[model samples]
Target: MILKIGKLFIAAVIFTGISALAVSAFAASGPALFRSEGCIACHTIDGHGGSVGPNLSHIGSQRSLSWIKTQIVTPGAHFASGSTVTINGKSYMAIMPNHKNMPASDVNTIAQYLESLK
Candidate 1:
């Protein structure tokens, strides 16, 4: 009985460790996706990207996670394409491409990353 319990505890510990590592890895993927996914071409983050879109250095404070996700997956839901939209007192044309076909995992991770800016 003692050996069985010990083995169970060991398995639980290993499972927990693996879960933690996976969560951390998923969380870390957000930043890399932000860059590799071409977000930098139109959005500025921490003063390091283009000026076409809103500065996202503090987007978390202004937008909810769900809203960010919608903006990423279907920006047209928020603003029509080629229409002028005002954000943070700045005017910008709603030219952001839709990512409706992007993997849901990538969309979630990118939204999670942007939501963490606060």
Candidate 2:
């Protein structure tokens, strides 16, 4: 009976490990989704991506997750008191087209991922 109990405990541990692995797998894919959505074209996270916008290496520390999500869904909601996104030696409005077509849930995922970028 002791041996059987030990086997059951081992199985439980294995099952928990598998579950944790699955969760991490999903978490790992969050950044992939950001890339797939073309965010890389304008933003750089993790020291790789684009220079059209500011490098978001520490965005998680600078911006709240909720603010990031809202900004993703409706960009230009707030702009700095000075300056704007410069393009090709010219100043342009800080308006980011809202990807309204994207599902809110996906946007939320992206926001969470960006929030974790730091």
Candidate 3:
């Protein structure tokens, strides 16, 4: 009976390890989604993308998950008056085009990726 119990415990441990790995893999998908979705066209990640939007090197440390999600969905709704951004030597009104058409799952994945930037 003791040997059987030990085997069961070992099996449980291995299962848990596999589960954790799977979760990590899922979380890592966020970055890929961000890139595939063209977020890099306007935003910079770790100094690698464009500068049309704010640099997102440490965005996770600055904004909450809910705020990030909202911004992604309705960007123009949150900008302050008189706020502007310069892109490619051209200064434009600080209006983030809404990406409301993006799939919710993909938005969430990109949000997850941004949150991990911290």
Off by over 4 Å in 1: 1-28
TM-score of 1: 0.78
In model 2, residue pairs whose N, Cα or C atoms come closer than 3 Å (at least 3 residues apart or on different chains), thus clashing, are none
Candidates 1 and 3, the one with greater TM-score: 1
> TM-scores, in order shown?
0.78, 0.63, 0.65
lDDT of 3: 0.79
Index of the highest-lDDT prediction: 1
lDDT of 3 at 32: 80
- lDDT head-to-head 1 vs 2, winner: 1
lDDT of 3 at 67: 83
- Give, for candidate 1, the lowest lDDT window spanning 10 residues: 23-32
lDDT of 2 by residue, 1-118 (tens): 9999999999999999999999877653557777988888877777788766667777788789999887777675665423476544556457466777877778888888888876
